[model samples]
Target: MYEMDGEEIFVIDGHVHLWDARQENIIHEGGEQFLQCFYDYHTGFTPEEEQWDIDTYRHYGADRMTEDLFGNATADMAIFQPTYLDDFYDEGFNTTEQNAELAEEYPERFVLNGSFDPRDGEEGLRYLEHLKEEYDIPGVKLYTAEWRDDSKGWRLDSDDAFEFLEKCADLGIENINAHKGPTIRPLNRDAFDVKDIDDAASSFPELNFIVNHVGLPRLDDFCWIAAQEPNVYGGLAVASAMTTNRPRKFGEIMGELLYWLGEDRVLFGSDYALWNPDWLVDQVMNAELTDEQRDEYGVELDVETMKKVMGENAAELYDIDIEAKKRQFRDDDITERFDLGTHYGGDAGAAAD
Candidate 1:
């Protein structure tokens, strides 16, 4: 929990990963490039003090993740967004199976999201069904740009993809998080385009299309689509990273989102590992919208709005009762860590350990 003014705000990191990019996991040059790209983002955008070396970044397992998110950071509950690059890694990069291990160990603190490749056809559907039964998955992370054997990438609007979406709706998976960020191996820049999302969101009104990174580098297009589609939402992962390095740009993006999607439809995410939630949370809570920014974008960044962006919005989407969960956190490991003031300088007496 993060306190601001006189209120305690619950934080839900809507996007996080537990990936293994170690040398052993790297199968080819593409895998190496992918890891290096992520490293550059970490080192370039993140504060120097917060940056980790290549080895640590590769295999920073569950213990470090727990310490960074639940122990040191202000994330009450984190949703694990799996990115499986089977062609690039031996065990696949951050598979749902791997994330489930952590979610199982700390069920109260994590939400495990599974994934599917439309290109996989019937076998993929079966895999998704198995994932649903095993993990009781509430959502799925779709990486449209992921490489298959022959195909470079797939789109959400594709016929096979629609079939998967239809099955997801049938199985009660409401949240569909699509990765429309940086390009990866065997995929072109067009593969990450947000245009496909507009079609998917329009076709599937029952499902919620949370565009991760807010379709970064194509924010205007995403905003235009999300404005018309009521079920479309914006997930702040890479966008929030800009808070440290490019706060003004972050403010501009937030203003655009607020203007188009409103406060309720915008969710906060630290994109953990690339960045930690502690500083991100602090930066967001402390950030202000200048009068010029407000006049330019026609929106206000007030306390209530911040509260919604920090946690309320995501909690509502995930069907979590924030107040009820707050009570349970009193005895959780986070409470103990916060009480000890051992995690990013939180108040010792804020909650009993």
Candidate 2:
């Protein structure tokens, strides 16, 4: 948890992944290209001194990930948003099982979300059920633009996709995290279209639709749609990175979101590995809207607003007991491992070695 202005803000990074993008994992050209694209974004936004080498970026294991997220105690909790690109990778990119490695190790500090491919048809539905049964996933991260065989992508409003949404509802899975985009590699406008979300959100009022990256490059459309669909939310994965060198722009985006979706609907994400939560969390915590932007949007990025965006909103979505988790963390395994028990009233703080 981050102590900002003397108030304890329980930080829950809404988006993170334990991925394997090593050369061996890259079975297709797109896999290499996709990881490269992620690297590009990482380097573009990350500070020079903090940047990881290409090799480490390709495959930073579970231990490093654990330290990056919790060793500092800045983030109280995190959610694993898996991006399973089966077609592009040999073993699939960041499958549920892959993320589960870390999530299982630190169950108290992580929420493991699963993935689904509508193209899998009956088999896909079965797999979705399996994920729910095995992992008890409270939500799912979907790449609508993920490649499957020769098909480039699918749409959220499609008949096939609705079937999966129906199953999610039947299974009591409420959070539907869709990767609406700013054009990541192999993800295009047609595949990552923001308009499809309108019909889907309208159709599944029972499910919460969290649009990752706030549909960048189509922020206007996203904001317009989110204004109408109460269940719709914005996840600050790619957008949060902009706060570093593009604070003004980030503030404008936040202002628009607050004006349209209000403070409750926007969530912060480091898109970890792309940007480490340790630093990104602080960057966002200090970000403020410029005077011109404040006048234009009539919204403020105040502590209360950030409290919701950074943790409370996701807590509500995932049904996490923040107080209970905090109490438990007083002596949880992570606390002992990282010597954070004192920070939580157990001992003294020590960085993860």
The per-model lDDT (C-alpha) reads 0.86, 0.90
lDDT score, candidate 1, position 94: 92
TM-score versus the correct structure, for each prediction? 0.94, 0.96
Worst 10 residues of 2 by lDDT: 344-353
* Best-fitting candidate, scored by lDDT: 2
lDDT of 2 by residue, 216-256 (tens): 87889999999999999999999999987888888888988
TM-score of 1: 0.94
Residue 246 displacement in candidate 2 (angstroms)? 0.8
Global CA lDDT computed for model 1? 0.86
What are the C-alpha RMSDs, in order, of all predicted structures?
Answer: 2.8, 2.9
Candidate 1 lDDT at 78 equals 94
User: Which portions of model 1 miss their true places by more than 4 Å?
Assistant: 186-189, 333-353
